[model samples]
Target: MTTPQKIALVTGSHKGLGYAIARKLAQQAGIQVIVTSRKEQDGFTAQQRLATEGIQVDFHPLDVTNDSSVQQVTAWAQKTYGKVDILINNAGVNPTMQAEEASLLTMQLETMLSTLATNVAAVARITQAVLPLMQAQNYGRIVNVSTEMASLATIGSDYYPLAPSYRLSKIGLNGLTVLLAKELQGTNILVNAYSPGWMKTDMGGSDAPFTADEGAETAVYLATLPEHGAQGKFFAEMRKFGGPIALTW
Candidate 1:
């Protein structure tokens, strides 16, 4: 019997960067792409749009921040595909404002908690939920969509004035990536965090320098990496960075 094709789940892909990533993955033959969003309508719309382009895709509603929702999606994947070979933790939120005026206390208590819940905690939970399946197959690729703004090396330098909450969340995400990689050290599962650069998306904004297609490049590359490729590292535009470096947390 022929083996079934690989499966990929990309969250927040109803549009923008997530949409681009889903499209790219679908374009590859034999790859089943799951395009997900918080809303069923949005997910179906994205799936239909991709189908029009002759790309094989399915719609799944996933609200990364919600545990019940996460479980439902993972269960669906387990039942339908038996495993999720690639998981792109691309869902994130950035309610922006000037750093100085933003209440550090409030930011940490409210914004930071909420941001981490979705950007970091959700990623961790979902990865854990799917890890058993990967271990069974001895194959998995996890790409956490991170950002250059998360780089502590650039902080206090020329690139410091970006979205603080979003930055902190991704920084936490990078740390999680490292920890998971170390734990799964000898396994075939490869986990990495990537900064897609500033792109023109709802999150990246119109004035951003890169396009969604350009932004999705690193993510797609990392998703499709060979078993020998690097894991538990931070990457931006193909250049890997060292250590977790500090954030203002």
Candidate 2:
């Protein structure tokens, strides 16, 4: 019997790390990639760009922070694919460059709240929306895009900035991953988080040392992990260690 195609949904894939992850996932056999963006035009543009590369993927308008939008996309995926095998929570924001981000005392409460809303809460929102589908199929691979800066163990020693908002949000994301994996224990649905490192993306900026494609390496590995693979673990970029290496949470 032929294996059925797995449907993978990648949030905020219009550009940057998400786009690179989406592209790489689409390249895999037996997988249908769905590229989503908050802006419809941007998603369509990304869809076209990938098409030019001879890669075809579905497109959807998804604002992870919007309840209706998340519901709509989940409904579409269920109606069209009957199942969502993978979910890559790649959508996030980093306000480290802002002046307020330099110090916790100066960080605006609004900025902190917004960052948490997107980087942390939105992941929860979309995952909650998609989990039932994965549960129904008894198979899923969830890769949460996180940062090394959020690693609590290395926070005091890292050379990165004190962008309190971004760091705290990702910390929450890490906690979410661990807790979700605990809840999903004894199941095929594996959820894990990984640091993409400093990549050359809109958030990483041009001066960053790594490319988004390089950053996307770990995502592909986690998304295609075999049954009973690593769960609730934090991983570093695969390129950095030549394979998936667990990071200190």
Candidate 3:
């Protein structure tokens, strides 16, 4: 029998790291890549871009913050692919204003709340919808795109001191990653937070070192991890960055 195709739903795949991850997965022989964005037009454009390179792809509009929109995408994945084998919770937002200082007091409540809603809450929402499907299959991989600044391991370091909203939200995201992995223990599904480092993107700015493709490498690797691969860790450059892979919250 032929190998089964793994169905993957990559959020915010219209551009940036998400786009690169989706493209890389689609290029693999037995992976059916589903690209999603908050905008339908952006989804189509991304789909067309991949198609021009001769990769077959599908698009679904997703607004991870909205329950209805999140459910809509999950329902489509269930209907179209039978099950979602991989989930990359990648769509995120940062403070729109330039960081004048690194202090939490300097950051506005609105900005932190906005960042938390998208960065932490939405990833949990989408994962909640997709987890059951993976549990039923007894196999899945969840790659939560996170940042190194979220590492409480280096909380006091001066150079990595700022972006309160983004950093704190990722800290919450990392917490979610740990909890989810614990809850899914003994199963094949592996949930982990991955830091792609700074890259050339809207949020990363042009001065960032890594290209979008280079940043997407680890997330793609985690998404395709084997049953025996590590789980429940903060990873960068394909290795565990801090502490143990599995631990309590």
Candidate 4:
């Protein structure tokens, strides 16, 4: 019997690292990539852009911060694909450039809450929405896009800025990854988080050294790990280290 194509859903993939990851996954055989964005036009534009390159992918509108949007997309995936084989929680926000984000004392409470809503809480919301499909198939690969700045070990000493909200939110995401992986132990559904590093994207800025495509390498690696592969671990960008290496949590 021929193996069925895997359905891979990537949130906020219209541009930047998420787009790079979606394009790479769609280029691979036996994978049906669903590129999603909050705006329908952006999603369709991204789909068209890939089509020009002979890479076909589906598009879905997903607002990870909205419960209704999450439910609607999950329903669409279930009806269209029967199961979701891969889920990349790539939708996130970094408001570090805001003056208030420069320090914890200056950080606005609302900004912190909003960051957590999308970066941390939205991940849990969407993961909870799509996990049933993975459970049904007894297979899955979940990759949470995280930043090494969130590492508790290096947060204090790292040269990176104190962007309190972004760091705290990602720390929450990392925690969620660990707890979710523990709950999924002894199963084919693997969940891992990886720091894509500082890449040149809208979020990373032009001065950054790496490209989004380069940053996306580890996401693809973690997304397509073999059964019984590393689970519940944090990884650095494979491009930087030449291979997958677990980062200190």
Candidate 5:
């Protein structure tokens, strides 16, 4: 029997902004949203939580840093849903504190490496694994959840503060988004990097101005972009913020 709905794969969606994104997609887009997290319990809880809201959501265990885990999830997605029409690479990490304080000698190389593995490498790997299914249908939307802290323009202007490793990884992700978009420029796949404004999530901290719901708005918007919508652009919430900063290459 043909599935009754489209499928959206959202990573790190067990709670916070990821959960909000998945919930919105399921409720607004009428699609089967796959909620993924590293822990089974977390995923299950999120699945149950969304179900109570009268939304359709499924739990999947995915550790983006683990290739085997990524492969397993990709295989499951193909078998269960046939294809994933939308992918939100929302899984990321920011282990380091202030960028100024970080140094090659003082910084934890392991942590920095792990951060890049999740924030950048996994995104490319997962996208590659899922691209074929999307290609077959010639229709797809890929939204890479990036940060404004990754903006090179802002970093160079001295207006933006640095996060060193975290900023580097996000900038790399943005570059990947651009390259992927260019490669699939003529295809139905529209790839873009979305900077969900600073929100009060575990990563964004309680001092952030936006809530998870508010922060997820941009990602949800990009996930459902129309065929003619903008692609390969860096999008932030349409609100006033600090000036531009340059990213370290």
Candidate 6:
């Protein structure tokens, strides 16, 4: 008998960490990877690029912040892939609120609200849409791409003002991870969050310590984990060019 193939949907996968994660997933056999982007053209191009490298990939257009777009993508996932065995919520925004702008950053409603909408709300919306499919499969792995800045254990009072919007939004995302894990307990589905660390991506910036591919390692690992894997925890890179290990919640 032929082994069944698992389907994975990775959001904001046109470039950066999301693209790397989608590529990593496609590298493994029996895993059909869906590479998504808010821009339909980007998604198509990414699929083509990966196909050139002999990867099995498909394109999907998704805008996590928009309800209609999220619903349309989720329905498309169901109709085409039948089920999304793994979900990598890798889409996020980190507005460049440099130290120079610290004083007014907090009060900047556009930056703060936009970050929350994409980083927190969209994560929940997409998960809610794909969750029933995961439940139906009785096996699912959801990896919420988070950041170390979100860690309360590490973020002292002094750190509160740094990237306030992005940090707070991730903390919110982490809460969703815990809540979802709890709701899906005693089942095969597992939900968790991990930090990809500073990588050389548009979001991470050019001076970031690592490359996008390196940063995506942990998310890929969590995406393929077994039923007994870690749940509702945050992870970060420990060793140089290594995968992520659990960090404090």
lDDT tens string, model 5, 115-184? Answer: 7898999999889888888998888899898877787877666444445778788989999999999999
What does the lDDT come to for candidate 5?
A: 0.82
lDDT of 3 by residue, 101-163 (tens): 357777888888888999999999999999998988899999999887787877667376588
Superposition error at 147 for model 5 (Å): 0.8
| Winner on lDDT (5 vs 6) | 6
The residue ranges of model 5 lying beyond 4 angstroms of the native Cα positions read 1-4, 98-105, 158-160, 238-249
Candidates 2 and 3 compared: the better one by TM-score is: 2
lDDT of 2 by residue, 42-65 (tens): 999999999999999999999999
State the lDDT at 35 in candidate 1: 91
Where is model 2 more than 4 Å wrong at Cα?
A: 1-3
**Per-candidate alpha-carbon RMSD to the true structure:** 3.8, 1.5, 3.2, 1.4, 3.4, 2.5
lDDT of 4 by residue, 164-223 (tens): 999999999999999999999999999999999999999999999999999999998988
**How many clashes in each candidate?**
0, 0, 0, 0, 10, 0
TM-score, every prediction: 0.90, 0.98, 0.92, 0.98, 0.90, 0.92
What lDDT would each prediction earn against the true structure?
0.81, 0.95, 0.85, 0.95, 0.82, 0.85
lDDT of 2: 0.95
Which pairs clash (backbone N, Cα, C closer than 3 Å) in model 4?
A: none
Candidate 6 deviant stretches above 4 angstroms: 1-3, 98-101, 104-106, 157-161, 238-244
* Model 1 clash tally, residue pairs: 0
For candidate 4, what is the TM-score?
0.98
Error at 147, model 4, angstroms: 0.4
